[model samples]
Target chain A: MSWLWGAVIFWLAAWAFNVWLANRPVARSRAVQLFIPALFGVTLLILWEGIVRGLDVPGVILPAPSAIWATIRASLPVLAGDFVQTILKGALSGYLIGCGAAVLTAIAIDRSPFLQRGLLPIGNFVAALPIVGIAPILVMWFGFDWQSKAAVVVVMVFFPVLVNTVAGLAASERMQRDLMATWGASYWQTLVKLRLPAAMPFIFNGLKIATTLALIGAIVAEFFGSPTRGMGFRISTAVGQLSLDMVWAEIAVAALAGSAFYGVVALIEKGVTFWHPSQRGRT
Target chain B: MKDTAGIATPVIEAKGMGLTFETNDGPVHALKDVNLTVGKGEFVSFIGPSGCGKTTFLRAIAALEHPTEGTLTVNGMTPDAARQARAYGYVFQAAGLYPWRTIAGNIRLPLEIMGFSRDEQEERVERVLALVDLDGFGRKFPWQLSGGMQQRASIARALAFDADILLMDEPFGALDEIVRDRLNEEVLKLWARTEKTIGFVTHSIPEAVYLSTRIVVMSPRPGRITDVIESPLPKDRPLDIRDSPEFIAIAHRVREGLRAGHGDEV
Candidate 1:
């Protein structure tokens, strides 16, 4: 009961601090921007820890944060193996192959009206198919290894990137095209010089959207069938064994990995599309 | 070769030119029975109200638009062939500089496309930047520059290839009067220095009178030429030349021609 009361007071105090920091007249530095989110996250963790302990919740249902942390420290090698197998081998490779194939297909689609009319609808249909439906079939075909997981990620990522790149190919302004025409530029020259550069922002937008999808598809597909050593496999088996702390630890690893993947892509987008209007400095 | 009156050979010739666009409403006649000739080293202005096909005519010359009837030629060849030969540079109303490119990068684009060597591209970019009085602004991005400066950078882009003929479509129409006047002077100086044949389009009477040796006045709604005023103003014009009697007479004639175009619509 005392722990619950302490958590309530701490939550109120942290909320007040965040509001005060946000309302400050001076602009926040990079450190403050990072610090504020970290503080909020810590406060939530504290509240979560206090409430579960005070309530005396059963570990099988929801383990306390300390138990989760202990499980994470104890199972570091197993987590590392799962991370490499699922993320580096399956998700990252599929991301590269899917994104590359999508870009090329987008170019071909842009070149031909027939392909645009025919393939886009087909692509949309593929995107609409649920990952659950595709995952089982892919596992059946590719066997119960990382290859099946990668195949699922590829299917999940392809359509978003294809649609975005197709749209980006059409992003060049009319006047810019006219300028190229006046120069007597060939079709290839115009595409390389004007259209591709104009498409950078939209392409990056598609790439960023695909990063999360790749991870989700790779992990979820592993649940259909994996080599007994993935985040998804561990999560499922841990739940059956009633090791809720292990499940929480896997969730934490997934959260960190997903965030790092998204952050890296966002950082690359910042570097590549720095001239975009959206990338301009805030007043 | 210049004739006795110092007039060079015809660079652009149009005869009975017509264009009709099929929009959803109906077929809109953009130009009809247009006839004109622009000689080498001449500064000709096409002045008319909005939708008068001045821009349409310019686009035709650039090979961006095709005439459904009649014949038009650039440098004694088809507009398409002339475009393939890279005989002209075109400047649009907006600056149209790519924001991603630096000022020098924008200027180098045409040169690069034409497969000019790196050294020559650098040389021409420097020359055109100096010509536009944008020296030392080579590294700045388009968005970092003022609107007027961006337009000048675009002009420098057109000038970099050193094409014999230049076509401009209301290039300064968006600028404030002060910037317009300043750019007008700089353009005249550029024309004097380069001796390139120029076809300029504008709606402003003073701008037409000040910059053009010949002004082709056009009317809209099946656009047709109503008057072709030959300016007697000398080549060396000061800003105060607008106050002179000859300038005023030309301006008045332009205004009357514009009013006549409106009257025809009514």
Candidate 2:
């Protein structure tokens, strides 16, 4: 078809342009660096739109990026309410409580050797339980509100942070500890000065992993039951009604929001653990 | 027990020390009835074979490991009491610099722990950095520096607090021969300036002979002292000293003693 021919020509042109751009001479300016990537992403989007329209794909199966954008513009009020309810209220609160409690638990476990032996197994087991399995039970227990969603998130996030912190606390070298011992440093002094700072990279690793988890938990928990305002509820209900365009719009929002949340945590992690080798930029 | 008030008395004196670790093969005696004394402002080196108790003995002195059957005192006080009194500094095999900290900041750790005033901490950091020849590299992280530089920083840290005793455990074991020679001279200069009592542990024969006033060579199984050699080298040393017949003789003697203790095992 003429449409297929046009799409292929455009794709080939974009590919050639990408290859040219990547192999360009060093004398190229900085603006080209930004422009090249933007050009590729836009080309991909345009190709997607062209193919879907050319094939006459059902809206339920696929929505063009422009169609998704129009739907999002029309439903800003609904989407904003969901974002507020799910992310700001539920996910944020759950994240703080869960991470704080894990850190405190890690300290306690580090103190009592008996607790470390007995409790770490339970914490690891708890971490392995699926969010899908727990969401319904938590909704039943916390009674189908934002409270249940937060509880699910807390369950989802608690162990990774705790285990990573405990492992980090133990990661300081023997010489470092011996130096403290020779200095006549008290147990508290050594922990405060050496072990805690050494544990920072691991703690940030756990925090970054937990960020995406917090988002996932908040959204999934809404599927079991909620006040019909959260993201999970809208997504599930829109799918049932075959409002594919609305679903695509909500997905676009979730992807952007989730990415933004993850990016912020990663930036904070870079600031906190700049000494870590993993954070060093080779390029 | 050593005397209570005389500054000339031995700063650290151990009477009949013993250490035994219970293993799957049964009790392994790591140290046994080892008696030694380190006097004020003396430089002593503990040299021995791999399994010998030189490190164990020093750990006992630091109160890091307890001796099972003897009393040890530092400056007429218990090891724990002496540590609390901040009587000594220790440098381990690695530089033990915190990777997160800058070179100057790692040197400042002890001062920070003791709550030194901000101005005093800065002055001390500046002084020690220069003393170690690491001036103007204050803000560079530990990982950014080479091994020799990091070890120099570690030495600077031990000297920063003006503590009168230093225990260094194979501090230059990882460096090349050239760097080790330089560090050995620098450490001697530091000792002369500060007049600190130093107890060093090493496995190298030439190293022991070069820097030590007295070298205590030890043997392994149920680890015990084999020989104690007093060096005849003058206080002021020259690079050409290594080529001197006197240095070679002492080094050969140490190697023989090490072989006497170690080679018979297999």
Reference-based lDDT, each prediction: 0.92, 0.86
RMSD (CA, Å), candidate 2 to true, equals: 2.7
lDDT of 1 by residue, A1-283 (tens): 8888898789889989988987775326777787788889989988988898889889987788899999999999999999999999899999999999999999999999999999999989999999999999999999999888889989989999999999999999999999999999999999999999899899988999999999999989988988989999999999899998998999999999999999999898888777888986732
Docking class of 1: high
DockQ, per model, reads 0.83, 0.75
Pairs in clash, predicted candidate 1: none
Instruction: Please give, for residues B1-266, the per-residue lDDT of candidate 2 as tens digits.
Output: 22234347688887887888889999889998777777898788989877898998888888888877888888899888888888888888889899889999898888888778999999999999998899998999998899999999999999888888898999999999999999999988888887889999999988888888778888898888777777789877866788899899988888777788775564
Per-candidate TM equals 0.97, 0.94
Candidate 1 wrongly placed segments (more than 4 Å): A20-27, B1-6, B264-266
lDDT measured at residue A73 in model 2 versus the true structure, 0 to 100: 95
| Candidate achieving the largest lDDT | 1
lDDT of 1 by residue, B124-209 (tens): 99999999999999999999999999999999999898899999999999999999999999999999999999999998999999
